[model samples]
Target: MTAWIILPVSLSTFSITGIWIVYAMAVMNHHVCPVENWVYNDSCSDDTAKHGYPKSCCTLNDVPLISKCGTYPPESCLFSLIGNLGAFMVVLICVLRYSQVLEQSHRSWVNTTALIAGCTNAAGLIIVGNFQVDYAKSLHYIGAGVAFPAGLLFVCLQCVLTYHIAATTLDLWMAHVRVTLSALALISLVFSGIFFIHDSFLLQHLAAVCEWIFVIDILIFYGTFAYEFGGISRDTIVTAIQHASSRACKSPGSSSTSTHLHCNPEGITMI
Candidate 1:
């Protein structure tokens, strides 16, 4: 079995990939088929038979997600092949590299929760990667599952848990630092939450806010990873992170830090 860290990171990476696929399809003037119809274009579209209720034609809702996605055609798959494969490979690489660290790292409820979220996401990817992908498009059914944990539950936990982790540990400075940082991470979480509730990414489809939520969650995620790694890997994090395909975080970005976990040498910034 893979280590605990692998699970959360996998969830994050996979969810990000799902988002990327959707974003790409949208940009290409394609849309994910909500219904599941795979016949390219609106050619095979059958409205009366699709939804229980009959419609003029298969609007996006009528088309099957198994096949239809947005407005694009099957050729979109040829375009997204490279990016899709690469994202999966990256997920594999991250787990392999951190396998050792996860073995001996401290276990926490937050970590467990993140794992659960990741597994759910992985299941979704399996669908997108295997049966349903039209080039790079994903159903987001998987992405939403993963996002619930990292973007919602886990990010919140990082605050209280980081504070608790900090306060209880031998290092007073680190504890205080965690307390402050975790507190601040709450802010990002708030905006991210609002975006999702409204289905807007601070723009259209506020739900797309999920992209940044995970991005911010990663900072805190990295911090937790650092704590799990014990000594921390200054090198692994310093590199520029592309994040998920949908949206990329800024360079030299810090993962989510709670408002509470502030100060100390190993501050949230380090994450």
Candidate 2:
């Protein structure tokens, strides 16, 4: 069985589950108000008199955005840990994807661009996790600024590459799925950005919801990679490593056996 499929699965599952857990922790600790409460209240105000709770419970700063959800003590640590590990997995997956595309098709700059965008997104995620919005507002916004667009670009580029290299009906369908996902992600991002700038509490809440949709859409897109990755075998990774070694050897002219390091491309799958 191919083990590479585990990468995307683990990434999506861990990140999605981890973020929701952070949200729950924030709610339980009164760090943030529950998202459901936004439906009933159109304004961010003192909920103490209404809910018969303390004045510190569910204030304006406590809106349940993902960043806000993880802004507090214990959950913030988990958030940072998740971001670091998720970023590592994202880098590994993007590298494997680039190598796979290189082996399966004529090497193109699009694949390389996508790899860069993925890495940038991962870097932004790291910053977002480590720099809490409440504590480090500027750094957190900078990270978000980098992450959102880069992630959208990566998914869109992957959609194009998927169509370009498609060999079967399933590949075409997967490409279509990716396109739809990227489109929705773009729309959600735009709405989130526009609403986020508004001063109204309701608009800001909607913006937060849109942000959630955008993030979850990106995670789902990553999960789709598992379908293609299922075709990969141990030999695929070995060949990619050998090919890199061969290129390194050829560049420096240090070894005569560089020519013999050429791997059989036949082992690479179209998917």
What is the lDDT of every predicted structure here?
A: 0.39, 0.84
Identify the candidate with maximal TM-score: 2
TM-score of each: 0.36, 0.84
Model 1 per-residue lDDT tens digits across residues 1-271:
3244554454445545654464445433424332222232333344443423334333323322222332244433532342355335434433322332233344344545544443443344344344343333445435434433433443344344444444345545555554554455556545545654442212322223333444444434433443344433443332212111112332245354631243233342355
* Superposed Cα deviation of residue 240, candidate 1 (Å): 29
What C-alpha RMSD separates each model from the true structure? 16.0, 4.9
The weakest ten consecutive residues by lDDT in model 1 span: 238-247
Best by lDDT: 2
| TM-score computed on alpha carbons, candidate 2 | 0.84
User: Model 2: clashing residue pairs?
Assistant: none
